[model samples]
Target: MTADHAPVRGEATGGLFSGTHAPATVSFAAVMFLTGFAALAVVPTLPSAAQDLDGVSLYPLVAGCFVAASLLGGVLGGHWADRAGAHRPLAAGMVLAVVTLLVSAASTSIWHLAAGRFLDGLAGGMVAVSVNAAIGQAYPDRLRPRVLALMSACWVVPSLVGPPLAGLVTEWWSWRAVFFGLAGITVLPAVAVAVVLRGPSWGVVPAPSGEGAPRPALVVATAVSLGAALGQYGVSGWDLRHLLCTAGALVLVTAFASRLLPPGTWRAERGLPATVLLRGLGSGVFFTLEAYVPLLLITERDAPPVVIGLAFTGAAVAWAGSSWVQGRLLERSPRHRLVAAGAIVQAAAVVLAIAGTLPATPAYTAASAMVVAAVGMGMFAPSLTVLSLTHSPPGRQGHASSAMQTTQNLGQIAVLGFSSALFNVFLGGGAADAVGYGAAFGLLLAPCVLAALLAARARSV
Candidate 1:
């Protein structure tokens, strides 16, 4: 088929898993499943690992470091994908994951665990951006939505199985066993995928390297990582030096963030920039609110672990179903309208969360709110991705993918950090824990509203 006449979802000709691309599609799905499983399975074990390594005080760093390091990884991955092809970086990221898991598996100290997580995040970030860029390059425009939806669906099985399996492994054997087992299982499949997808016809052609000019992208990427790390450290401590660290982090972010995003991204310029900004805004609110879900349920409502688990599982299913809905509507509906509608749903979810704080509210009220909000995430996340890929000019898809991922990381950190700080302040001030939860959810409503308002800008005018 010619590039001008491409196959789309629901076509009589073929689906996403058909033709010469079938092997690559299957390989991509396999690796995605592995990565998703690893990502979720490891989370529930982190508390045990932290206590074992005496890193309980620095527990937040474990997750924060991953987000911080992923920024650099995303930048490097995008540059490498553009300069060479997505295959090399994707393979490297997979290998890097194996190595990092080994490090975590062998860790005897808190710093070692942190180092492993940081490297794992870096590798995972690279893998994610490269996969997005690769999909954009490999698939026809019409099929992109279906492919992205498929990627989201890959998380469903992981969400269902990872936590319980990890808990069982941790209880029966050891946390290290989980890491070692994942690393061992991922190696052969990752290597197999790399070998299968090494052909030049995969559609990712290398861009010309500029003649001896300094790599501005690299500089900006490094600055973002440093800023995130410094910011994390500042939040971890309460001393004077921590305050200085916060100042330094802010300076780095202010100075370098713009260099990484689209020119008018800071101003929410229409089209690509607005698309990227909306991704950040939507992700920021959802993730920040997600972090507090378990806390509110456990502390305020006395929900059990099984109930908490059920809430997350339901959200995962809802997210997948919503993604499927968007894919089916790709031809019938416009992206901007879907995004705006999704954002409104997100806002409504927040309101439900706030309402859940009432003493008379049902026990599942907060959980229901989270699941519904995830539907909003499901609707818009893939749509924005498709927009980001389509809006980019030719070889710059890698850069566009990197920008989206970077903003996502930054959004999670910044919004969650701010909301967490607010929650802590309220708690310290002797406010009831329920009051703190309410205040934090109230604060989250602003970004959700902003994201909805900006969704129109994601469309081509």
Candidate 2:
């Protein structure tokens, strides 16, 4: 570690809200809350927007564009942070976020809306990476967990309110109103954060100098992002064209995605590699469940939309609560143990979801799957992040953070795509709907188990 890169221990004497850390902490938290609100709110409006634009067939492309663009954004933000400081990227991301919202609000066509979403994703990815890098640079090791937990908590209110509020606006007015409202509400706070971050105190630690940090390959990142988006669009339907697109996507990701990650990440090498891999595994399990569980309930169990909404709200609350426990009560626990326990808990949740696919099982059983999985993620996600930062070399925390972000997006794309393929195969084989759902949920167990087995690899040496 360089002299300036030394850990800033015991400097947070007055805590996160105290004199020194208050401005940056509040600014970051506020930005997170707004970003969460925009993300959760905008998703529910996309379907309505597509319908209004007469481009319903292209909805998957529109939806997937954000994730694709985020891959590029993560690399860009991480590189910028390492080369400069996290504060600049953070401010730039917030500004771009507001601009994207306005762009969406004025959209006259589906492609325009897709462009806005892609820009939003880019901004979101930058903000996410920069925030993690900032935390690594600004906070001490001891305070990082709490900061992460607080970041998780920022999502709780957004998850509870964003979707329903968007629904109401769409019902009473137009879907575009949501974008305009978000932009109007976000602009001032975004500016405030930008100004606050410019202060000398924020990102006080200078970036690591010399040849320790290597720049990420932007071309490969672009391919992976494009591949991920195409993969998502391909899976929306079953056709020869879609299959070919999916095949091409697989080739793109398989060929170049590994170059962006730490060495041995695929094999879960001990230390940082394992930590990054664990992020993917745990995220894959949770996201697959989140995507499928609600669909299962609505399609098979005849559950109401209100029921589904409440389930989402409950899951967010559970995640926040569990994150709180890990950050405070279990603050001293070994992170590897927490990760292992979380994986086991997630595996149990997957089992419950699978059981809910049975004819005799009640609808609530499946709806609860997301809440349970969230509890596990609450423990698993932050611990992996802490481990990644802890294991990172002096000047490479940005690289590690970017790799974690990249793998997380890849995990979502890969796991969800695979599960969707399995579900389609069962349906095409003339199996019953329950059978298809069962097969999909059944596939999730493997990753959860593997995460448990590899948790120890992430332990500090």
Candidate 3:
């Protein structure tokens, strides 16, 4: 069905607010922030959870599964948003999250925890895609970028609150209490979204003349992208060594997603294409560096878990600070400039982390450098993202959102997957572990450099 066949609203309906409805903008932003908050809140308690549940290796599985499930959710949610409209999926998603947290907190086995996480991941995926789509459909072209920034900022909050909040809570009470705390906190916002999202007035029915028809190209691309994710996981897990698998997955996903993306996106020529490319570059390089930083500190530097967590926190804090600053100045800069600067900052951070591999440098020195790099990335994010959202055609806005998100996630999966594989190459022997991890870090440095180059070119082309 094309946009012409869909219903279009003649006048603006007052949404959740009293005068001109903000179209649940606040609700969407709140939901996103809460999602980030939940992620942080859960991690600190996860280990304590393991101890409470008879020491299962389910810790990694629980968190990993949630992330894995999100990949599924992000894809399906895009299509679902196309069909059912955003409100239903968005509302249903929140409810799903609530239910999952309850079950996760009450779990006795790893499977239960995993199941809850999967369900929650599913919901998060739905909320992210649907809300994103709604923002595209409901708002005028200009507001879209601002909304995307608001939405993206949702992930930033967890970095700030997730670690310490979880730390203090777990120390004072059982880790399980943290889950309960999250549950209690969610109720208020969930209810607010539910209330604000009510009535047909607040809803966004895909426009008849708009671009939201579900495309077969997207389904194929998502399938290929998802398969690629699985293949990358195999590589990361060391179960598969066929560079063919990783390479094949990347090619397939690239081809499929290209069809779903705008005309110039495959080549990443300029304008919105550049923005998409920056999103990929910034996220991939930033995360690839992040993935190994912990392992480096723990093994080579002999840092404790708390120290490792803090190092992670330092980068996250930097990330959050950047996000806050960028959001505050949403109207001032061109998107491409932000992307270019962010890319450079991110690459510099990777270089610093790379240098830290020398066994002699103070761990905090490397950590602090990474945090500084994150601040640069923060500058890059909202602008690059806002540019994409504002530029996307209404009919294809949902696809754009998914495409950008897919690129970011795929970046992490691919670059970090490679990082994981290389780290495992030297797993057992102490000497090998040091050398291997360093080599892996060394291998990825070029991409960050290349990404910076690409981001710089984003504006010109």
Off by over 4 Å in 1: 1-13, 206-217
Candidate 3 off by > 4 Å: 1-25, 50-60, 137-157, 171-173, 199-201, 205-266, 269-274, 304-310, 327-330, 426-432, 456-461
Point out the higher-scoring one by TM-score: 1 or 2: 2
The lDDT of model 1 is: 0.84
Tell me the tens digit of each residue's lDDT in model 3 across 1-461: 35433322223434333254453767877888887788667877787777777745445556555655565566666666666556777778787888888988898887777778778877777777677777766665445445565565667658766878887988998777877788888887788887876766444454357454456544674465455544554564433444665566667665665554456764667666766766766676677666677767877777667676677677776776676666666456555666666767776776677777777777765565568667877777666656665665544555566656656666666677767766766664455565776767776666656666666445522
Q: Write down the RMSD of all candidates, one decimal each.
A: 2.8, 1.9, 4.9
lDDT of each: 0.84, 0.88, 0.66
How does model 2 score by TM-score? 0.97
Task: Assess every candidate by TM-score.
Answer: 0.94, 0.97, 0.81
Off by over 4 Å in 2: 1-10, 203-211
What digit string (tens of lDDT, one per residue) describes model 1 on residues 1-461? 65433332122255677884577678778888899988889998889999999889888778688889988888888877776777878899999999999999999998999999999999999999998988877777777788888889999999999989999999999999999999998898689768976775654553445422123556778898989988877776667987798889889998998788888997899989999999988898888767888889998999888878998899899999999999976545888888998899999989988988877998689888889889999998998998898787656778888889989988887887677778878988999998899888888888888888998888954
The best candidate by lDDT is: 2
lDDT, candidate 3, at 351: 67
Error of 1 at 413 (Å): 0.7
